[model samples]
Target chain A: MTILRFDDWTDPVRPVKRDVIAKLPEDAGENPPVLFVPGPGHGATAFAEHWLPHAAGRGFAAYALTPRDGGKLREHVHDVVQTAASLPRQVVLVGHGEGALVVAHALGRYPARAAVLAAPVLDRWATMGTALRVNPLGAIPAVFGGRLRWSRRQLLSAGAPVEAYGRSSRLVTSRKPVPKPVGDPPALVIGSPDDRVVPRKSLDRTAARLGGAPLLFPGMGHDLMLDAAWTDPIEAILDWLTKELSAAS
Target chain B: MQDTPDIADRHDAICVIGAGAGGLVAIKNLREHGFAVDCYERETSVGGAWNWRHDRSPMYASTHLISSRPLTEFPDFPMPDDWPDYPHHTQVLSYLERYAEHFGLGAHIWFGTEVVSAVPVGDGRWDVTTRSTGGGAERVQRYAGLVVANGHNWDPAKPEIPGEFRGQVIHAAAYQDTAQLRNRKVLVIGGGNTGCDIAVEAAQQAATVWHSTRRGYWYAPKYLFGRPSDQVNDRLLRLRLPLPVRQWLYRRTVGLTVGDLTRFGLPAPDHKPYETHPIVNSQLPFYLAHGRITAVPDVTRFDGAAVELADGRRVEPDLVITATGYRARFEFLAPEILDTDADGRPDLHLHAFARKHPTLAVVGLLQGDAGVFPLAHWQSVAIARWLRLRTTDPVRAAAVQQKESTRPVGGWSRTKVVHTRRHWFEVDHVNYLRSVEGLLREMETSK
Candidate 1:
């Protein structure tokens, strides 16, 4: 059975367990904690303010990953995936914006019960150039500044159009496609109709590529979890997770 | 002349009317071409449709622009990266306000001053009359040339129903917000974007919602494959194919034509194919797909709490919203200079020069699958160039007008027009801009 408890990563952090779940109900024993991945300039605090209070009221053991600065993307993903793997029960991953891309990478390594991708940047190369407003070339140095290094072949394999960047340039090539999960999990994709940064068409394309995963298109701003329109869809996702976990149990 | 005030009040240039999307762009173009220009606006703020508030404003609840942010953005001003993909009304307004501020357009604009009349003077000029909304003294101004950018949507088209329904009936034009619709059953009439959005908002609040469409329509969402479908549609519209062929190709690429709304559980419309409202954003179809909204046929009669459809089905509703569309009202403009088509739109040749008068031009009257801002801006530039050439070389201006006289009026005709009834796409926007640019460039070279 899944248990909910607060564990501090930082030494100075307070050890508070305000709402701990000792054990999941027998019916929901196989269910996992809903891990929220936030967007840029946001962290767990934002999730707590916008979604967690209401989610907690609805019987969800919601948890947000604390934001880390100057960390390698793969390392962070590995840490989160490792923690989720050690859990007694399966877990569902929910991510927004750049966090969505991170979750997808992590999912490639470790599959989850299900995933809810809200405004995720699946095509990192295209997204870096267009959606995120960062210089595509500049993003390379910033994201892989330290220990992490991406070769041109790796970048080319990861869906970056090699010819557009330059055929001769070795460092600018795409990364290899992340390996697909053995048995694909059902995914729920949510996006804003008014999301100016991500092309609205991308949301549908992402859903279609996922083999007819259910989609929740809301006429809202880019921030899905914070928007009032998300209430119904989030509830639906949690309920679906609960039912699936209970059935497995 | 007995020292009359009317004779003493003669002015130098012609008046440009209505400082909305069309007017602002036109004025900027004229100023760029070094033409002495003055623009008059009825609204207190700049951003025409954008300036109109959300609550109690016709543009409230579930309204996202069909145009891509890139294409919808004004020239030289990209939309902020942090904004949502489809910008809200407030964002659009702020963008427009910024456009005006960036161009120093405020000084040229006379706000709260309604143009009462524009009588053509015999010598290539117009006698203009204006009344301030604050009840100040009426003012008269005249100019060398006039451009009408007043735009459409100020007047609401109320459908002529046979009987009075007991339910509260509201026109989509006057609809401010959805707060009044909470917990009530709503019947939203019309299949246009406004009607679809109203239905979506109503479904979120009301106990139930019944959307009435006069005909079936294919709705392309704001995006496709994570890119703006508008961009795709815009590109398709610009191909060198014939008009009919282009229409057919457009239907195929956009996915599903009329009578296809049933797949989404939306009712097929029953009305004759008239002019379709351009640019219905994609949000409404998703709402229908979720079963939050139900679709029905046209309203034939109203029976207090119940409404009878043309299909002979009846349903009761607490609130009825007629998203039936709007008419272009230029009653304030003098009848002599303002000539209109059967549908009440001003008849202009090439959407810049009026068929009735040469000195007076009309911008923003042309509405297609493309956005009006870029088109209006470009047309204004053309008009300004044409005006400059006319003053410097009258012979050349006359010859150009004679050449254009043989061409058909406007881009899309009522009969030949293929109404996608979808929002503006980037491809269409680029093509239209290019076309206008080409036209202006040609005019410049001719001079």
Candidate 2:
């Protein structure tokens, strides 16, 4: 019942130097900015390659964050919340995979304009179960408290650059109940049925928790931000955010 | 409600008085819950007490946060990581400015507009009258609810000492810079955090500094074990350790680090640690040891430029600064509505929701061991949720109102503190935040 977090008080999550890539539209609009948080292994370049520029070109101020500290989930959440606070206006949070969990944690703190969860890893047990079957060697390291190495096939579908498969980082998971966000901002969940890392049921559960059905991007892999069909998901998010923000105003 | 020629009807809109830290967050939370809000501020900008430019702000030039950044900043809008553990008042103002801009709260605030009165017009609605600071025609706006967050630090509580002094005497609220203290015999009265801060400043600038206190206080160091002391103390608070154990730990630590105050010719604290508001100043003790400040007993009377202490010692000073805290003043509303006590403090349930009116509430009025901004944010969130519940289900809202009326008073203060006017709203930060969280859970589950 007492939500006074002592861990945060005693051992606070200090800010770290994060790699951020930002792109502003030539003619910036009144729409809220969108901050992109990449999943484990991937950095800001995951979104910077296509999603940030594409979204900015579509009249939205876009930013992608690579939490270089690689600390606990709260640190990543702190990075997202602190970065979002620094922006000129309230931002829409877009988190992918492990980053989606960080965004959910941040949602409990920051009142974002909107939220977008792409290829969300809602359940670690379910995701690791799928990973074990799809790529056994990559999933074995995760079980031993090491970084999970995602194969090129696991990250992207077709026509993606070799560098798109990001460097591995230690992934932390928790079973605590996600805090109900203030304002209960509108949420849009996106994933592909053919993704290797996250199963369809996991995406559906994430959508159910956020009060929506997943917007399926067929024939795509786990890395929606680096997939050959990354444009579709980015466009869908920009369109949904535009409508949500306009309606709220 | 009917729209008249003069008074505008803000249909379903909530009216918030003040755009300082409390009012700004109130507006943000209410808007987040889908409520249109209009906030009126007397000053031209925000940052209620922290805004030094505001005429009534109590902030001096050298003021820094007593609580560390982690304990002080809002949960959502944290202070920048690069800032020090204790940031200056100007940094606080800029942080507030960043919060306002990030949340787009500037659009809803009416700068330089002061609320004249807020009269409850049945059914939780209020008729709020306002006037421009630039001296314009008065305007009245009717709203569905009212949130009074005009802040508690602006009004100075100048205590009466029997006789008048011919010297330049000013409350800490009016003491701005070193110009008032330079090369003069300065007597800083009261033992609160502000008093210790002013005394330290006087030690730096004044020719001779005499610090006066009615009673000895437990002086908490700004740091303990290489970290901010509040952060270290929070470990015990988080573990839900008993009050006696926590106090013992604090006393032991202070004894080891600071030794004894009596050894420095100051009175030993009569009360236990945590009995009074924690004075987080390490500099005061340093100055006392260095002979920059002479500790004196309480002043009994003022004779011309001379002051007589309780210990039969007389000290004549060129200027006197009374750092005796402040009283919460709600000038726009009737006193009886908030159940004002003899000490001019409001007796609202949980120091927030009004018992008489379901929609009337106040924020940022309590004194806590930690930062006030996070507490204000939580209070605003609870108020916003309660207001939202009122519209969706009036029956449940009325039940909550009934429950609020019966809720016990002073549950968050941990234990019995010294019964002084200054301790009227003292709360243990952990306990108070937990209670507010409990209230929020009740409202959400009932809905």
Candidate 3:
């Protein structure tokens, strides 16, 4: 989409769409580039740096966008939809965490060839419940007040990496609309049993609601992309998507 | 990992002919989509025409990019900023090599290999005959599909006039070095960029230099307002002005910067500046005015040691160089394989797909005044995606099939592909880009 501007104060993270980390292939004949959206508190590099080289290694032109300073959840969704719409070919939307929520919201508005949602925050309130159980001491300030001012120890205990946690908004006030099951281009749902931030069971609910099977990796952290065993889930998504795309075509 | 060469190992592998820029893009894109690909290059390496001294490279020693670096290079794999506005052939070759290595395209390519023939076996499969450039034996293999990116600059076209000249005659393609021109009077025939470049070059070394033209060309300066001329035009495209207005504006700028050629003995341009590709040269105008080079009329006939002009003038020179241009040659393919017009150029759909022989296709067959690298890339994209849709999504393929065309309308073509004389596959760069965008949009919406 067009350049979307947000008040820098709102999104203190200052999302920037920098040059991709790896060399991309030139394809006028195939599907569009992969537009990746990072999960909550994570920047474009958080998810992209982990898998962009791999995506390029596989022959796909993968790119990402870091959301700018503060805006409502709807604004973030709008930006993602517009970005996908702007591509030359039908884009493949791969989003993680809150970024996954953006991809889910983007589907009906903007048609994609396929979608991949990794540890999506489907229901924020339920996500808050998981946040409390993981670190109850830090949960009080986040719920009562408009701040998620948790220490690094609290975030680590809650299964979040310092890199992603640092960029996340200190407050969560937006109510996102639930997405219907994806059936048009189909979708690949991936998660890890050790994902304590969004919780592994939430991934099952999301997969069921989206009418797709859950691709789960056991003993992996919420930062599945950064974890050493990230390939397990990345390859799973890559494998399922290849077959699903070929079968559909 | 791409070294697996047994066709039986990959039942659905795509075979790409030529490992040049066009074929490189095709190979990489196909692999990215999960299709196994094998790229065959007759040369020891890639870069296509940009590679100097390659078996098929038409590049002269002084050959620099006609388009600027920003316009010519791929967007994702960009040339370094330190590079000149227009880089030499060596720089371009290095850039392409870096692209191949950066994308790990080495394994995908088979260096020093030639495709002897490719015949459609049946049901979207091809029986390809290839031979190693070394003393190795020939071998035949099966592939799911074939993409012909052999390029169109190999064979030189030599036109015949009424009288025959017994002097030292040569085609511009063969004039790789200028050492032979020293102390000799040279006459370069043709009005295209090659003719102009050599005429200007011969002016420096040859005793006397005369450039003959059948047409009048609008000469454009290499730069405008301190930026590459094409880059300035790229910025102008954002305004989205009407075609006539854009042409008029460009003509005015050219007139303001590079004055009338008639004063220097060159005839005024017969066609509008936009009618044909812009001949960008900074030295031609300077050399003509300074008396280093003389511009002459069309060569009506030739005599031993003498050349007669249409204007009733005659010139006797030691050498006659014909920069007449090249013809589209598919030396490896049989005549009946793909349909061609009277001009001998293939009449493939979108300048790519051959519907009758569904398993066959071609890339880099079309030309635009702008950067052809990007154009080749887009053509490769169309071919690769179409192959995927042909098998994966028939409903979408049906929709795409509806848009399948043999016309140059939606393609980046200026005149028809069958037009007479030089420039059969020329394209209006901006119009071509828009047309490609439309095609891509139509395909995306179909799914």
Candidate 4:
């Protein structure tokens, strides 16, 4: 339940005030803790709270990154790696939805104890096209930081589950080459076959690049963690962890 | 200590069972003193329980060494410094491989060989028989001595849960990974360390994880004061602090950090702390506190997947995992040769030597909180030297027999691990180690 703030990665020389939220474990020990990266615009408290408590209860020190005026996709990735490296040892890094892309990008430099990318926004255009279909006025941006500009009201109210919305405007213009995961035995990607947000092809590609199959529950959708059967995805991750860890050892 | 003159040469080979941790160390110690040793392992690999995929491996997915690396590593050969403090099961097996290779124990090891039975004749000799794993050949080789290094965990101790459990039930020994638990509601029976570990994993993967315990258990964190808990305790023992002071210190530490079990809805432990084996789980209590996992009473009965608790509540789970402990078994040896109490524990004099037969020695046979590796190492040393000196020095052998100390082992009570069924052999690490030191010293000191 403890909240910790870490320096933002976008301004590494003199990072900004604590924009990230992490639940410091009561005790940190041999087993490394988990670092969670929520999708940009959606603060850590709103999105990452769902599983951080679960991780803590299971005895892992849990963390959540909150990029308020979220930066470029790589900046988010840099922030995740920096935070993980700062920890005592390698940690399990989990990113949800668009945040999954950040985690996948981070995996190239800092291979984690295990990486979980859930419903990634791999091909930015396709993901934005899918979002545009839902909100023509709210075509979300792909990059964050000061590159792209948009009104706060327009970005925050986009239709998403539980007030957890990602700013599409902060992403549109800063168009550097988007990072695709070149993961060796890639990160454990979690995708939804029935996801309405991220395109099916993008999700499949994410899994294929990661080298492990996507854990897609039959009836679950894009917001698997917030779904009534949320336990399904969590369980899959746990089962996958058992295999991954045993293999890593 | 110099090896005694042999009536027979190295041709008088000693037969060893199962190339497990105990068996490997036993073979190495015996070979160190010039004993011709031929070890048998049913599995091709040298590491026994640490070999995850081996059929005999009872290790679950989340298994890590309860004891730390430095403390658990062998005396002469240490684990790689890069290994984590509490190395995972795979790391442990690899360490064992390195140990086997370093000591050249693999040369005399007969992989895919299983000991069928060991029978001792009237005199101090044994008829050892072994069969190749894949129906290759049966060899009945006579040996001067038999070292039963085969551990006690092979036999699954299935607690008879009264009533019908129509749902899928599995013993923890049979559990391989978490695949079976995913997308299913699981109920874990028993609250031992294994049970707690499996229950914690089940909570993460299963639809709903329910934990049932017969009674509350004392819990020990993996580390204390930035070091492994066992190492800290070993230090405390080295300081030679009084027993009461140590117990008091431990009770205070656990009470302060872990807090009361009743606070987490778990029943208070029936016995005092350190009375039995404390559950060495660092996570189970946390989950229990958050209500992520529901703790229930010992099961009264089961109807299908539905389990009725001692309290009237019933839960219909998809899978029921019995994380029950194992019973000590010596199936390969003659039942009559080793006498026992009412329960099945072999009534031995020094936890290693047989009271009736001098030819048989069960090394590393007892349980202790301080990693069994060091204890097994010392026990093997004592047994090897004792085997060498018994006939040569009768008075010293008698002295070794008479030097039985009231060792205070964690989880020694008949009611704890053994339950009402049998006596669980618990070895106090300090006392047993000291007594073995005394035995080793006596072996040297005697004329």
What are the TM-scores, per candidate, against the unseen true structure? 0.59, 0.97, 0.68, 0.60
Worst 10 residues of 4 chain A by lDDT: A1-10
Chain B TM-scores per candidate, in order, are: 0.87, 0.97, 0.93, 0.91
Model 4 chain B — which ten-residue stretch has the worst lDDT? B1-10
State the lDDT at B244 in candidate 2. 88
Tell me the TM-score for chain B of model 1.
0.87
How do all the candidates rank in terms of TM-score, highest first? 2, 3, 4, 1
lDDT of 1 by residue, B65-167 (tens): 7665545544323345345656887777777776676456788888888887777767778777777766656666667888888766656778888887888
Question: Model 2 residue B437 lDDT?
Answer: 83
- Candidate 1's C-alpha runs over 4 A off are A1-249, B1-4, B7-12, B53-57, B238-260, B263-281, B341-343, B409-415, B418-435, B445-447
| lDDT score of residue B99 within candidate 1 | 61
Which pairs clash in model 2?
Answer: none
- Candidate 4 lDDT, tens digit per residue, A1-249? 000001110112223444556666576554566777767745677445467666666556788877536466645665676666555555688887667777766665454667788777666677666656655454543222222222233222223344543343344122544343321332677866666567778877777765556777655556666554666677677667767766754
> Candidate 3 lDDT, tens digit per residue, B340-392?
76668777666677868766888888766677777776666667777877788
Better of 2 and 3 by lDDT: 2
TM-score of chain A of each: 0.64, 0.94, 0.80, 0.74
Tens-place lDDT per residue, model 3, A14-105, is 23343333337564234346788875466677656667767766667777777545655655765665555445455788888778887887
By lDDT rank, best first, the candidates go: 2, 3, 4, 1
lDDT of 1: 0.60
Give each model's whole-structure lDDT: 0.60, 0.87, 0.72, 0.68
Those runs of model 4 whose alpha carbons end farther than 4 Å from true positions after fitting are A1-249, B1-11, B402-423, B445-447
Model 3, stretches more than 4 Å misplaced?
A1-249, B1-10, B134-137, B161-166, B406-412, B416-419, B445-447
Q: What is the lDDT of residue B355 in candidate 2?
A: 74
Instruction: Give model 1's TM-score versus the native structure.
Output: 0.59
